[model samples]
Target: MSEGASFRTYFEVEGEDRSRLGAQVGEQRRRVAARLAEIRNVVAVMSGKGGVGKSYLTAALALGLARRLTRGVGVVDADLKSPTVARLLGAAGPLALSPEGVRPALGNENIRVISTDFLLADGRPLRWREPEHERFVWRGALEAGVLREFLADVAWGPLELLVIDLPPGADGVADVAELAPSLKGAVSVTLPTDESYQSVRRAMASAQDAGIRLLGVIENMSGYRCPSCGSTEPLFPGSAGSRLAEDFGVPLLAQVPFSAGAVEVPSGLLDRFLETLA
Candidate 1:
């Protein structure tokens, strides 16, 4: 046989062991469920669309919750294609692996974190808008595989809360629900515009259809806060969060004012938002 034919035949032999591959995948899923069980609460922070500071809010929520919990909080950057939790929270350390499992890196306030970013190019942190981050283009089954590995392998020990930062849309949410059915719920984040409202409504519907509870909605960048004068200003014409919440029967958890500073979420806003969960 030619080289190409020989290569194909080699893979054909491997494909014959379908049962073995299936068994291995099944066992991996079980391990993932077992690992996630140790965490007290698993909540996915998501948005119907991107560019609404969902990832930043996720990190901030983890930090806030870590302060309240004795065991500390963790964040799984489930945005497989563009993992940012590690970079955002400065948890971009080399992931340690032992016979036990993959060890998550700790960020500020003793909050543990794990992400595909840590495994990139020897754990070098990816700067925002880096060309390297754009190189990855995963689809379909590949997304599911990477997500499963994160849950099954990461050794997150005794976490009070595991906040998963999911990429925009229903696929990411569905993947988490499938792997960890015990998820506490999802906190939808969105902006204060009609455009954002429509997307968030779909997100709420998707979660409900999947039998996942919609905890609440947080309106980020709802208004601008003047740092110099401590005055609040509405950046947009109006907020649709109230109507959206009413339609879904979920509360509008908090209207986090916009910040001109580096962080997307204001300090006080994060604290008040977490209180709603209590």
Candidate 2:
């Protein structure tokens, strides 16, 4: 049989019938199993609220791991409501779909990316009118079957790690906790501000409630360092990284300084990310 024909036959046998409830459950199980088989580590980057630089950190972490480690990495932009990994990585290519499954994501350094942006028509607004609308989008994207298809059916190849950039707040944590039990841990991001700290603490608590391990806390825009004088000043006044780490019993991985170059997505931001990883 042709390669495409062979793939179709395999998919038919493996994928459960969409109409049946039992089949749905089986499909979910298969997808989760497939994800477990493929990726070695799955890290969810989350925050209690938006503007904590969660998505930026997710992209940076994936790139960092991929560039430094021999094993490859994939990033799932689980922030369905506001997917931005595609834009961050500059993946504007059309998604290839076949009877076998969806093709591997196209982006910088072979970083496999899947986001709700890929599913939408050009310029279509994803804003939900009601709570149910939001839930449907979330369920469709992150639930077992769709997630499995993204993982199993796609040509992700072998990955050492898969970093998921979830939507900001408790909703994102709940989504991953409900879907994937293999979540290795979460890296909560926060700014050095009183409000940001309180919000991030709540997010950490949500992860704790879900039994997800807190790998560390990353303090973004913690302080500004003067290149000429070497003087440092708090941009947002608060005890965030160390204090929260002590409270939650997790490490303070790094305090990322307020660098305009660090936050920009394109224009050599990947190189800055590598430095941070180092």
Candidate 3:
């Protein structure tokens, strides 16, 4: 009878499809690892949620680290949708292509940088041609593929360190750690607020679970300083970042005051980073 027909699951029906997908992913993974192997160390700067100046912190750390090493630093702006590292560090492109791979742009301190923004011109946004519902269904997978491509194809050369400016949450951290075999540790950025605290705490846990050690915490926009008078006032007043570092058994690396000078990386910052990440 027609009612007696056996049912089959999608996995059973599409076993070959799954194998093909796995092989594709594994190929990309191998490329990424081979590329990253040239870099001496890999670290990620991440935030649990956005609007914590995480991108700025990433650029600052890279610049700081570059000064400490002659080999220089590299950055992969993994925020495929809204990348700021390129603009933040003045890595304008149309990137170059070499026999090795796609060469990353040179930012300040000659920071080797790769970002989607460098591919798009004149502040154009990256959007899928698909409809909203279709984008929702496949955007995550698409973004992951884009990230793997960036990691694998960029000609970073040999670097003292590579800092990844991850988009908010654990997904970016996990992906970078997986792609870059020698990933050392990750720094969490947060504001002093309950929302930031809750999200960043979970993010740090996710990073640790992903096999990347929690190196330290950065409390950005901690206070506002008058550019002219040099007086500091409370901005987002709380102990969220300090408490997070304490709870995670990591150091609160710095309390960055919001000011015109804030864009300038403090010289002592690298000392602190080396002490902690060392």
Candidate 4:
């Protein structure tokens, strides 16, 4: 077989077949090295629980950093099971694949996105049997050298920052700690509620155990401004984000208020976030 064909066949296998494992490992390393050369910073956006607006924050940060960062920005939807970045960006559909890769990332403005949602047929559910099932999928992709090719060979041009939108809870955090060691730090997102704050604290500790730096915390759904009375109401109450940041020696970067408009991704807010980074 030709070199190109041989490389293609390496990843086109099923299950944990350890036959060509050595070759796969070497290829993965090379891919990781190439990806590291181009992408300067990798930051994971994580939350301890669901309904805390983690995905929205990831989109905001990516769009924000993309506008400010010199090289460019990309968002990797590491939340494989519930990938929604593509839909939020209005790029949900069949994606074109090339010899360059399997599925191409959809681009908007300066941001490029990759997600499992792009792989599935319309409305297909990613129902993994066990909790380890998703992790196994991720591991298989990484081991088969698909992830390296996805990250390194993809046409992500000149990225200064790569934002990873992780799955909710500690599983995603554990995966990042194990596989993607090049991540600069993690940006934890949480609501103003005490329960949400406590969950975020646990996540922080998990990341710390993995030796990942806590870049900062972002409080979402924080306060709503009453247009009539000109007063701010605490939507969820308690300033737990501030307390956690102080306790962990990390910055409480921003407290984003809930907007009453249609729940489309806020390009204006993203622009403002970029400006702040600038």
TM-score of each: 0.82, 0.76, 0.88, 0.76
Among these predictions, the greatest TM-score belongs to 3
Cα deviation of 35 in candidate 1 (Å)?
A: 0.4
Best by lDDT: 3
Model 3 misplacement above 4 A = 1-21, 129-133
> Candidate 1: where are CA atoms >4 Å away?
1-18, 121-138, 262-278
Per-residue CA lDDT of candidate 1, range 52-135, in tens?
Answer: 878888877877667767987888898766777777787767788788788889887788888878767754653334344434
Query: Which tens-of-lDDT digit does each residue in 163-253 have in candidate 2?
Result: 8887787756666755667777888888888888888899899889878888888888778877778677778888787788899987777
Cα RMSD of all models vs. native, in order, equals 6.6, 10.3, 3.4, 8.9
Whole-model lDDT values for every prediction: 0.78, 0.71, 0.84, 0.71
Clash totals for all candidate models: 0, 0, 0, 0
* Model 1 residue 51 lDDT score: 86
lDDT of 1 at 209: 91
For candidate 4, write residues 121-155 as lDDT tens digits.
67787644346655965655553343445466666
Better of 1 and 4 by lDDT: 1
